[model samples]
Target: MYLTSMVFLLLGSSTSLLMALFSLYKSVGYFIEWEIISTNSNSVVMTLILDWMSLLFLGFVMLISSMVIYYSGGYMEGDSNMNRFVYLVLMFVVSMVALIISPNLISILLGWDGLGLVSYCLVIYYQNEKSGAAGMLTALSNRVGDVAILLAISLLSVYGGWNFVFYLNSICNDISMGLLSFLVVLAAMTKSAQIPFSAWLPAAMAAPTPVSALVHSSTLVTAGVYLLVRFEPAMHGSKLSQLLLLLGGTTMFMAGLGANFEYDLKKIIALSTLSQLGVMMSVLGFGLADLAFFHLLSHALFKALLFMCAGVIIHSAKDYQDIRMMGGLSKLMPLTTFYMNLANLALCGMPFMAGFYSKDLILEMAFMGSINYISFFMYVFATGLTVCYTARLVYYSITGGFNMGSLHSVNDESSLLTNPMLLLALGAVAAGAMLSWLIVPYPYVICLSGFYKMVGVICMCFSCLGGLCYYLGSFLFILNSLNYYKAVVFSGSMWFLPFLSTQNLMFQFLLNGLYLHKMGDQGWFENKGGHNLHSSLMKSSVLLEKMQDNSIKLYMMTFLFWAVVSIIIM
Candidate 1:
């Protein structure tokens, strides 16, 4: 029964993907029109006038979704709730499809909200306490972002008074282009988990591996980058664009650092997802919206492959996710190891891999464009950090230790898992080769001076080599002086700066997610008077229940007295 259900689900998703690809092909000359009724008497009409850009994004989304669906079937095999999982997965693709095709803001919001809800459900599908908590956090964070988007939309409607069609027709004229740009940027940062809004993503590793791959790598998070790319014209010359550039650059650097320090394999990948999104965000900031979209396309392919490889390792290791406990498994699991390392190299921006093309384009754009020297240096440094952390992940997973203990005594029974990893591994290698043809009028200008490319290559070499040396030195130092490394570096210091010796203060802050969550929760209950209101509600409810249970005569007399008082007051 489960097998049949899975087959049916795959069929539906594949058919939808094919239809979308066909539509994208036909969209070169096609046009669409629709009507949306408002609460008022007037009707708002719109047209989804397609062009090369929309078709490109549409095709990218479809191709990625098809791969996700195929991998999901293998990942979920033998699970009892296979049917339910497939249903939600398909719904997620449908929502993304609608979002890509929608002409106006309202239609896009409908699809966006649907995807958010389905993602929340998928996060909590395991029904465990940890998964439930993570899902709630994801939903709350997204809801706050949604409220900001709603306010911006309402303000635009009130001030501009332009219907859907007219707004698109005169997008630049109707709105305070500045305000619209700010709102959209905020929405994108929140959705993509940049900086202060980024804690939710690491916690979301509690979900199934397939869910993590689909949401983090391919579909849900990519929506934010897609939005910025789609609405580039409205945001071109605003302060928000500069802010996006700075924030995205900073996020990439910080996230790469965090990924390097993480012990869990899944958390490492989660952090990489954030770092890559930051790079894409920076590309959008540089006005290379087409390049940003193309990077998003390639990232989906390689990152998903990496996650699937990690899943295979975890499954074979008997659910052990800590990279510290894994080593030399390349001998036992040669195929899995090869795929993982291949994907990791691509992720590190090695030449000829999928990531190299997109990342190099962004770096070149940052240097050559109107962005100041400081911003350009920051981006280049972040790219170097990307290489450092990616190398750390690959080394730790395959070489650091042989502490597998007794877990690998038994092996994984499912051949289904290996099949998807093999397919994705091939993608990680070959996807970039197709980029020149896939995108129309390939966006990169390649204006880098010979000196510049040489400097960039040197930086890449240093990052990779430096990271490997650091990892090896740290390991040997730990083996020699175990107490020193643990007491000063691992236990006392922050994740970013591991040499700082302020143990008590750093430990307190780190335990609470750097005090950000504590501050937000305190502000909600204290400044908002939520605690006092809750106490009052509880006391009043208790009194009412007691009065109701005391006596029928007492209740009747109370009601009569209230009725007489009401009439006299009136």
Candidate 2:
């Protein structure tokens, strides 16, 4: 089953890539038309829906899905339900591909919902209590986002009588469809796990490593960014775009902070995924939609590599996720160490790596945009934080103090795993080198002067230096903990502070995922009006149960009476 699925995925990916390249070269638009008569007028209209953006997205889905299929075959080798896991993975990829090629709102919704369903199944593959709970949480959160999108689509179709192409055309002309744009943007923000909706991604780390890689790198979280880019024309120049920018910026900062404090390897990667998505959102919101797409590609490459490396490490370490328990692993696991470090460098946006070009493009574009100095400072600060946390990840895992009693000794023994890491490492190094040529049309000549290159080199040097200082001072030593120390100082003086407590507050809020659901539940049940409403609902539910029981008996009696009347008539 795995082999067959892998072949099918690879074939689909190759076909999609060929189509994309053909579309690009021939300048022939990719569209599929379906004619439907209006219900009232009976007038036939053809919906022309598809374009380069959709084709590009389809190509991406194909490529990544194929890679994931190959990766999972090896990753799931020892699992008891390996066949079932492979089936679910394939179904998930299929849903994503369907989403990419969907031409109408209904088709897209079906694909989106199917993806969510398959994702939930994959998340709970372990069938553990925690995994099941996490899957339910993910499902609920994703359903909320999906419902918003579905509602927006329904409204557009019902009121505007606009199909996908018609809606795109209208937006291209007006660019002020405020309500529709807001709905879509809201949906996108939630799907991407920005701000208040950000807790689900970390929770979803309860899944297997391959699922985590798929969610973080390509399939699940990228859906939101893909939607934003796909509908850019509809959303440009709207207040929603600004909202997206702010939400993205905030998510980036907060998730990076969370990554710094997290101990679980998968959770750290999950936080980093959120932070990277936030960066991409900011780029897309700022009208650098193309740059966001480029960054998306680079991020997928390196982030998947990182997750795969983490998986191997975790497997060897007997599922120990704490970096404090892992140290000097370079001796036992040279390939894992090398690939992980290389991927981390790319993640940190070190110069000459795959991430450097894309991230620098975003920064340059943001600088040129209308956002003022404060926003630029925020971007720089986020960049610094990214560097710091990523450095900490590398340092603690490979160079920190080693306590053998806390760590298990296991050999790094999988050639199947090492092969994938090698491929990703090569891509990380060489992908950026080809970016300039790959992105350009007609082989146009461009050159950077010696001075410009020097400046770029120096900026990277300073970023690395700052990251090192932060790691040594804040993370490695007690006095270096400026961010944590500042929070302590700020909260220590209030008379209510001791009663509320810093440790309790931190766990109950930040570490407890801000207790958002609790807050919502409090509002729903505890307040005066809410309490009354809950009582009313409980009473109504009892009434509903009684009515349902009575209706079932009534239906049975009616059926019996109808049967006797038929017999008499016969």
Candidate 3:
């Protein structure tokens, strides 16, 4: 079943890639719409848009999906429900493809909702407490994006159709367009795991590594960036774009800082994904949607390869994900080490690698743009942080001494895993240059000063040196210090973002509920609703009882008073 799926997906990928090339060469797109219903001023249609962007992204997705499924055949060996896992991943790819082809808001929701639902299933595939929690966080965080898309659909309903493509230009500068753009941006932010929404991306590493390679690296997380890219035309020059810029920069900086202090191998990669996502969003926020899309494609290729390498290592190490326990893998598994190094260098934007094409362009463009100093600092520092973490990861996992037990044996003899990785390594090596040439017709002409041109290289070189030095030095000694201890914990923990996303958010609501229980439910509501009513009823009943008990004399006096009043009226 896995082989058949892989074959079909590979075929689909090749077809899509051919179609993408043809579409790009011709500079044409085809839009197909099947009207489900049309009445008076309302219409419902199923739409599929086959453009260079959509087809090219679909090709990359299928290519990666095929590799991941093929990898999973070995990675998930002996699992009872491997078939179910493959099905869910296939569904995930289908959803992502659906989203890629649909320009209509209504049709987009169909795909958007599927991605969220299927992701929850994939995240909890392990069926454990940690997986369950991660799945919930992943589900709930994505639901925010889902709701945002739904709202955007409702807002677009007034136009007699739900196809947002038709209205982009007409609504670009309208007063209500800002609200629409805000909804779209909000949805993208949640889907891409930007800022506060980012905690779920790392938590989602509880799933199988194959799923991590597919979902986290390419399809699922990139959905938001794709959405923003599609809507960038309408959102340019809007307040929301500027806000997205700031948030993306912050997310980039934050994730890079956190990854440096992290030791978990999968999490380090996950944080790297988050940082790249921020770079994508920041580019979009800069109104360079084409550049963002370029980075998105190139990033998907290499990042997926990186995850697969991590999977092979983890499997060899008996599923231990901590880098501290891993060492000297280059001697034991030279091929996997080579592949890992290739992906790592590409991720760091080493010259002529897949990442260098898009990533270098992004940094250079940022320097040329009229961005604020904070954003400039983030771009520079985050680029450095990428190198720092990659260096740290390579040092601990590839070059450091073997820290595991002597009795353990690790090998890369499994062709099932290595073959897929070999395919992706090609992409990690060549996809960037291929994509940059294909997608970008004319090269960007930038006239930046020599100092600015060299800024990125200088920062990366220093960061790499710093990372190696820090790891070689007494890390324990530095960590044991009171001042550095707090800083390390803060940075390592992703600035307590997981706490803010789950515990802090949950606690805040719980604390508010406690206050409400004290002040409203138990205090004021009790006083005004049940307790006050009970007391008033009790007082009235007691007074009535006293009146009745005393009272033949009281009744006679009341009757005499009424008689006197009647006589006076007469």
For model 1, residues 128-157, the per-residue Cα lDDT tens digits are 998997887777667756876776677667
Candidate 1 colliding pairs, count:
0
Per-residue lDDT for 1-570 in model 2, tens only?
766776776677667667667776677775766667657756555443455556656665656555666667677788889888877877887677667666566666777888789989988888999899778767866777788878878667644564554576576455445667777777777678787677668878889897887765666788888877777877777677787788788778777766776778888888888889999998877876777877877788788889988988888887888887887777778888888988888888888899897887677667657896666667777777677678778777887656446547555677766765665677677766554344434432334456533444455567667766766775557765565766544322222222233235423654565466566656644664668778889999997887688687878887999999999999
lDDT comparing candidate 3 with the true structure = 0.91
Rank the models by lDDT, top first.
3, 2, 1
Clash number for candidate 2: 2
Residue-level error in angstroms, candidate 2, position 456: 7.1
Q: Which one is best on lDDT?
A: 3
| Poorly placed runs, candidate 1 (over 4 Å) | 1-29, 36-41, 44-52, 158-175, 407-413, 440-444, 479-570
What are the lDDT figures for the candidates, one per model? Answer: 0.72, 0.72, 0.91
Name the lDDT value of residue 27 in candidate 1.
54
* Per-residue accuracy of model 3 over 1-570 as CA lDDT, tens digit each: 898999999999999999999998999999998878999976666889999999999999999999999999999998999889889989999999999999988778989999999989999998999999999989878888899998888888778687788888777868766787889999999999998899999999998999999999899999999998999889878887888889999999999999998889999999999999999999998899999999999999889999999999999997899999999999999999999999999999999999999988999999999998989999999999999999999999998689888867788899998999888899989988899899887989988999998897888899999889877885656645565788878888988989998887955866887999999989989999998999999999998987879788878988999999999999
TM-score of each: 0.78, 0.78, 0.89
Clashes of each: 0, 2, 0
lDDT of 1: 0.72
Superposed model 3: Cα runs more than 4 Å off: 37-43, 475-481, 507-570
Error of 1 at 435 (Å): 2.2
Candidate 3 positional error at 521, Å: 17
What's the distance in Å from true for residue 460, model 1?
A: 2.4
